[model samples]
Target: MLRTRIITALILAPIVIGILIYAPKPLMGLFFLLCATACLLETLSFMLPAFENRLAGKHVDTIVTKASGETHTKIFAPETRRPMLITVGLAWCMFLLMIFGGAEGAFGSLVAGILATIMVGCFLADDVQLGAARSISMVFSLAYSVLPWVAVWQIYLMAPHSRYILLVVIIVWCGDTGGYFGGRMLGGKVFGDRKLAPKISPKKTWEGAVCGLLLSIVV
Candidate 1:
């Protein structure tokens, strides 16, 4: 896994640097927008099933008799594609608003509008409970996957331009690398096998987190 990560980084680093330094601002923004969309979709794909499971519990896996007298297991298969399409379309609209709206108030209003839309959608859905679950999952996925890229785009528009963006990216990369290596090498020794976030990330240790922070600061 480490070797794969290193090789992938080595291959993509130069291409990423080239784009960061030489690409036009609008082009870079668009690239990051696509990235954010992809990330959001991937996040939703991974999270929706888990969210449904939690919301439906044992009912999700219950067997039922159909009209044709066949037994079939009922699964919590929500409308995944439609929700994904709606979320992605709304995300694009948000990006466009960010680009042209300028005023922070306008952006805030747009966010409010989106939330209202989500609520309306929940009410209109055939299954209100499942719809609420899906809506919450979409919101979390958007925040987790898209907000940082939006921040990155905003930073890129700042005075120092790409240098600041590159600095942020390098710091993150260094931190991740440091955490991986530190955890592998000295995780249990310093922290007595304590985990940083055992529920969310079982492999992470306090020692690894400390090393990552130090590496980021140094870099």
Candidate 2:
């Protein structure tokens, strides 16, 4: 997995760097918009199944009995298409607003409007718990997948634009790469098997996190 990640990054780095360096502002914005859309879709896809399970009051794996009296565990498949499409469409609309309507008052107003719509819809749903779950999931997806790219787009519009973007990219890449390698190499050496978040990410050690932070700072 690490080797594949390295190889993929090597292949894509030049293309991404070239785009950042030479592409026009609109093209850059469009590129990031596509990225944001993909991220939003992925976020929704991941969370939708969890939301469905929560609404159904089922665990990640639920045991079901067949007519023949055989019991088997079933994993819920995400019913993500409708929600993903709608959320991605809204994300695109938000990007367009940023482009034409400007990223100041208009962007804020649109986000507010979206959130208000979500709240109203949730309020009117027959299942209040399900509606609440959907509201939380969608809000998180939008914030996580869309907001950072919007910030990056805004940064790209600043003076020394591409340079700023490149700096951000490099720092993030260095941190990620450093963390992976550091964790693999020296995970248990520094902290005596201490983990950063054992429940959430068992392999993530304090040592690796520190190394990544140091690498980011140096880079």
Candidate 3:
């Protein structure tokens, strides 16, 4: 499934990017908005897993101790989007856009709105009971959803040849590839008994991460 997702992302990125470069600003905006909405929808649904709800007496709240030693039980109440952080983020971002929605307002406001949205999402989802959910919904959502949309917007500003955006996708793909094949092939046993992340992803080794870093530098 991971391989399939990676492949799908790789294949569809170029198609979406091609449309962004070829289409008008309004159309390009529509394309990115769809992507952003899908990402946000998926990110928000992580908290209320179907199987998780069936489990009785399972408290999914994460406890965090602040620098001042005050404990905070952060409950990710994903019952609905009415009062959760996801809706809070969506409303805030749209509010920002609405605030700057005017004939005289520069196009920069839209870009700023997206960035601020991602920033707010990351901040609101600081403490999480599930590591996978936290990374995909909060951390990865911020970067993946916001940055790609930002890049497409940037391409609208520099149309006709938005190959630089393709470069970004290529760099990530190559780095991921290197991490997978290189680690399994060359990496013998760097992290003997130490687990990187047993809960979220048990197979991701330190060597794999280092290999990705090196591949990124090359890219």
TM-score of each: 0.78, 0.78, 0.53
Per-residue CA lDDT of model 1 for 1-219, tens digit only, reads 989998999999999988889899779878989998888777766555556557644133334456444333222234456666677777777766776665474468458646954774476356766777767777777778877777777788774449988999899998999999888899899879779998667889888888899999999
Kindly report which residue pairs in candidate 1 clash with one another. Answer: none
| Model 3 spans > 4 angstroms off | 1-17, 47-78, 84-148, 155-159, 193-195
Tens digits of lDDT, candidate 2, 1-219: 978997999899999898898898788878999999878876776565567567745343334556444333232233445455666777787777776666675568466747853774375345767667666667777888988888888788775549899999999998998898888899899889779998667789887898899999999
Kindly list the per-residue Cα lDDT of model 3 for residues 1-219, writing each as its tens digit: 568868997899778667645777566566666666665555445433321233322344434466445333344444323223554365336433533353234355545554555454445443443322332344444454554565455554553555665566677877887788766755647766454565656677667777887898898
lDDT of each: 0.73, 0.73, 0.53
Evaluated at residue 83, the lDDT of candidate 1 is 66
